[model samples]
Target: MYFRLEDKESYKSQEIGNLIRAYNRSKREEAESEPLNLYVEDEKGNLLAGLIAETFGNWLEIEYLFVKEELRGQGIGSKLLQQAETEAKNRNCRFAFVNTYQFQAPDFYKRHGYKEVFALQDYPYIGQRYYYQKNL
Candidate 1:
């Protein structure tokens, strides 16, 4: 077997995508998963904050959460998270998990009752990656 690493600016490769999709399908069969996407928009219909997650088995895995810069610290993030949690609960999820870097919103997630389950030091740079989970 031979393996090679090559860099591509476009990062759009159907071969890699199909490989991932096949693996994901196997995992989905192992445990049922449902996609959940939620977002907040202003009166003008501009996106402010949002959360993307998936509920699998009895757990919810949050893949992304983003808030516009101008809307930070105004409770928008919290509201978005709360809404996601509500939906997850409705789906019978008993726990929720997410990952955030040290320079990101680790503390914010902590404040929301998520405890650090794992930490990878100096990942992607001179920063840490934290995995957190909370009981629903």
Candidate 2:
């Protein structure tokens, strides 16, 4: 057998993810996972902001939350987060989890009641990575 690193968009990367997901599903028959992606677009259909997440079992795992640089500080991120949390709750999710870097929006998640559960220091040899969670 051989192993090779592949770009994130490659079919091999997708196959690896599918294999892991299949194994996980086989282990947890009750687990129901689904994507919970939200996006904001301009009138011209241009992308502005987005929140990507997934729900499985009783938890919502936030993968990414991004807003245009110019649109930052205008509450677009908060709005997207709030909407995702609401939808997760409606789907019977009991908790939400997210991770952010020191230079990223750690305080934003905290402001939304997500508590820091762990921190990895010296991530990227300069900054920290923070893991946060909130009860829904």
Top candidate on lDDT is: 2
State model 1's lDDT.
Answer: 0.90
By summed lDDT, which 10 consecutive residues of candidate 1 come out lowest?
4-13
Angstrom error at residue 109, model 1: 0.8
Q: Residues 22-48, candidate 1, lDDT per residue (tens digit)?
A: 998877656778999988988999887
Which stretches of model 1 miss by more than 4 angstroms?
Answer: 1-4, 9-30
lDDT of 2 by residue, 1-136 (tens): 9977755688877898999988987887687889999999999999999999999889999999999999999999999999999999999999999999989999999999999999999998979999999999
Task: Assess every candidate by TM-score.
Answer: 0.82, 0.85
Instruction: For each candidate in the order shown, give its overall lDDT on alpha carbons.
Output: 0.90, 0.95
Q: Residue 70 of candidate 2: its Cα lDDT?
A: 95
Query: Whole-model lDDT, candidate 2?
Result: 0.95
